[model samples]
Target: VGAALAAAPGADEAYGGFVYIMWGEKANCLSQVAHRNLETLLSAAPNARYRFFLYGPAQAAGYRIADGLSKVQFQRYAKRGYDVHMRLVNARWGPYAPATGVRDAWADQTNVGEDWPGEDRPGEAWWYAHRSRFPYEDKKHSKLKSVQPHPRDAFFNAVVHMYLTGGVHTDLTVAFSGLEKLTTGAEAQYAMYGDGCERRDAAYDDIITEFDGWDVSLPMALYFPDAGHPALKCVLDKYDQAVQNLSGLDAMERYCLTPQAPNGFPFYHEEEPHEGDYEAPPPAGMAQLRPGHGACARYLLETCKAQTELQDPAAPALKAMTVEWMGCDAGFHWDQWRFPYAASKPFRELAAPEGFDAAGVTGVWTGAALHGKRWEEPPEEHFISKEIYRAHPATRWDHPALKAGLLARQWQRENAIADVEDADRVFAEDPDFPKCAAALPACTSFFHDFSELKDMQYYREDAPKSPRNAAAARCSPTLIIPGAEKGASTFLYSLLAEHPQMISPLKGAGFKETGAYLAGFDRPGQLWDKTSHFPLIRENEPFLTGDATVINMVDKGAAKRVVRDNPNPKVIFSLRNPTDRLWSAYRFTFNVYYKTHLPDLSYANIVNDSVDGFGQCMQRQLSGAAAAAAGAAGEDAGDAEIE
Candidate 1:
């Protein structure tokens, strides 16, 4: 399958590429789940590229990269010699399909053959090879082309996005990590497809009964080794067919035995006006589509068949894994712990798929598991219900095995267990056993469970009152004075410090400047020690600390750093008459500091030589200001000199 997908020998370049898609403004509660899941994945695959395909405004969705992953986590990863990089892409631009405002090609073509052209039939191999155009016509199904809409329409854009920007397209809820081997596909197909449902075990017969009638065959997560895979195109084609109700056409004409196969003939066909002459159907595998509903599954099967000849070398043969959370499979409804479906099942049951190598199951795409509650889901969809616990008294959160699994999962997350090897150990080991189980009785929801498992000893160790961290917590500047150098910033800082409510950094032999922000603390190993700069204040004191770094105003990064680090810092910028400030600066630098070097030239001589240059600079500054004002008022400042 790897050879069939056309992957180069020993090049696992695509293994680290991951794709995450969100269509519209997702709620914060739901977005947090995605954030947590992404962070979890990064813990395991620290160097992987997490590409977010956001269809709508990311800010509106509260999906900022910094907001999702904490600064401390980034620092931790960076310290480990790994850069956790996430690439956010605007999914609306370029060759990508729009989520809205496209012609509803599926609207009027409810009856398959009536509107579909004979050449557009999906079964015909010619269309796959030649592909003149997408099957749908541009003509409006209704008078208004955009009138009718489907829930799956925007999701279809997700399919298009996966094709355009290939990688592993994952649902936000799915978490688990470490699937380098299967992903690189050193032994098997480049593409992999798996079920969203848990692996079927006879032991789970009673517990999994809630979803007995629900169709769980459709894969929640999809993997394609490369972008523009022909199989994905086939998936898109089938999706178009599904939207138009044309996907069932081949099955519709199966009994009729049409000589032309599914060559877009009408569903009902007769040889000679009721004289029943039997014709052979298409071959067995081609006769019945594998997924029945899932376009990807069907098309991948088709693409594999088409690749029997060497002409299409890129045709993907899918490696179908058993329906289990083999690490990479999504835990579909796992977080609906209150629901009957999840409450009865233990996490360990899903953690280790029976008979499989513990290491082989690398990642698990927990499909909408965290956020797929009724309220979060579409109105038409119902994933899990909170009332299930109320309805089923037998299914309780404190069930020993279920509680144990939940506790283990929590421990894995709390400890930042990056490797599956360590994660699996939680099932057998009870690092926080007594404490974790003691808190289980109080657990009301999935998020609240295993609260005690979190080692708060770290928090205790760095208590704000502790000598080392006291000033760090208290002295983080509430005020910053990034000065206009040579501006009377020092005098202003002195005056502010004199106020009973205000405090400046402990004045020493040096200037009242920390110079911390000037030297950027953006990257790892760059430390900003507030303690070294400011004196620790008493617990009862009502005082605000400040860093009056004079050069900070001119430092390009200082102001930005100040804003980023502080919550509501009051910035004081001291301004002075430009000419006067320049002269003061000149006197300070040339006469005071570098006076010995220029022994031959007196201050008067230096001033006399620099007057003309200073005058020109001042004139240019004034002229540029005038020009800017004039431009704002729609007037031209002719021959204005810009500084």
Candidate 2:
């Protein structure tokens, strides 16, 4: 036996090494067997090392030692230098306790207000801390009869049965003996164990002597206990029958539920066949050859065929083959007769030429009058009456030519023009104007107000410049005004465009081309670059990112000069009301594009969806904004501010 134990793998290690043994409650019989095996092994290899780590129902076996037996057999072995160390390892009954705390923590963070009870639960903290931890157990153990296990002890008994048999290993079992005592107490006259302790002692003696140092790990069939413990044996038999029944049922279900082709017959009951099949009677308006079996009248048959053709030409064509094969003298042959097909016709075609003449038809014309009759007459009363125009000569300048002359006179008064004659001389001397004049109609006025044109030149001479470019060129530089959406920034851009040294996209091609050249992308092509090139540094502002290289503009001198050279260099960050902005965001997210291009989400869904769902989407937007801003600032600031 010692030689066999030495040959066993994992047996030659140090004495008292940890050994974890686990078995369920229903496996109580294994406890004695395991103990017997351990004793055998220790006897064979007295110096072998091991510690017993008992878990599940196996732990209960350690508690089962009789008081007398512990002092005698068990304690004697311990004192006899047998190396056996036993310990209990805890088993989880349910999910971890920290998981429940995590759920409560989330609930606390999402609290809203008084309108929602689940969110604003001021009482929940105490309740969760004290009571919510074990709701199922509390309900089960409650004293009130109405609350007791829902339907008395039967429910709890079933729950226990499920816990025992449903793949859960626990250290407790309600055996037949225990249940009999619970149900009938001391009243029922049934022995707790069949054949009593004497029979059990005899059976144990026989089994122990024949154990023969057999390896417990070897596969061996388990047998039901003999009649000495009929109650335990009966329970084992019942469990075996249940397992066999389940396997048989599974096989039967697989066989019975296999799909079969549907029966060809329709679902309804079949009609009984007649001994001699009866023929259907001829339809109405037919001439009877035999009173009930008659040939359809020629007109009726023809009319039906024609109606069928009108409904579906193919149906008549298919019916034609059958009709011709029958060879009945019924004059209903296809194409033999024509049916009057009714359709709407134009009524005017039937009318005489003289009737159309009497209807007074006329051809389309572009002339001001038809048949030499005037359509529009000169106004008898003008919007500016002659007396009013004469009374206020300045107001008569509403006429283009008169307005130009008046503007010239005003310019002369302001000393912006040398004289009215000088204004006329400039207009006449302008090479561009004469080229434009040739294209005008001979009768139309060409001379117009030049005052606006003159004022434009004056403002153009005062524009700002970019300090970086000015320093590079050793001269005052031009400021660049970027375009933005409807906001103070846009207004500032427009205002800055009026300066002579300030180059803006709003200006002519020269300035626009220059800015585009410096940026290395076309003016319109770099629309997306606006975010990075002109980032919004303020909260609630839209951060732009047009392209990659815009960060180079953030240097100290460049940043200051970009701001200082322009008429209004300070960046104006415009923010609308929060509600309005939220609404706009909802619209843009759900509706701005064509139906197919738009997202499937509705505005209400966006506003009323879960906070986590909305938070996730906003988190993405915030991240994108942070990236854009970081790119512009040439720094790695994350989405902290946006979040």
- Give the clash count for each candidate: 10, 22
Model 2, 1-643: lDDT tens digits are 1121122222222332222222211111122222322333343234433222222111122222111011011221232244433322111111111222222311121111113234422222322322222123323323211211111111112212222222111111001101111112211111110101111222233322322111111111111111112222222222233223424222222111111122121211122222223222222211121110111111122233455457655441212100001122111111011110111211111112222221121110011101001111112242112211111111111223332433333433343321233445656676554444333221111112223322332111111111111112111122333322222333454454443212222112222212322433222222222211221111111111111112223333433433322223333334456667666655555664425544446555556775668789987888788888777764445445455
For candidate 1, write residues 149-249 as lDDT tens digits.
12123234445555555655554444434444445653223222333323333433343332211112233455656555565555556544433444343
TM-score of each: 0.34, 0.15
- Model 1 residue runs over 4 Å out of place are 1-18, 21-26, 30-36, 43-48, 57-151, 186-219, 240-314, 321-323, 326-357, 365-643
Off by over 4 Å in 2: 1-503, 506-568, 582-599, 605-643
Highest TM-score: give the candidate number. 1
The CA lDDT of each predicted structure is 0.39, 0.24
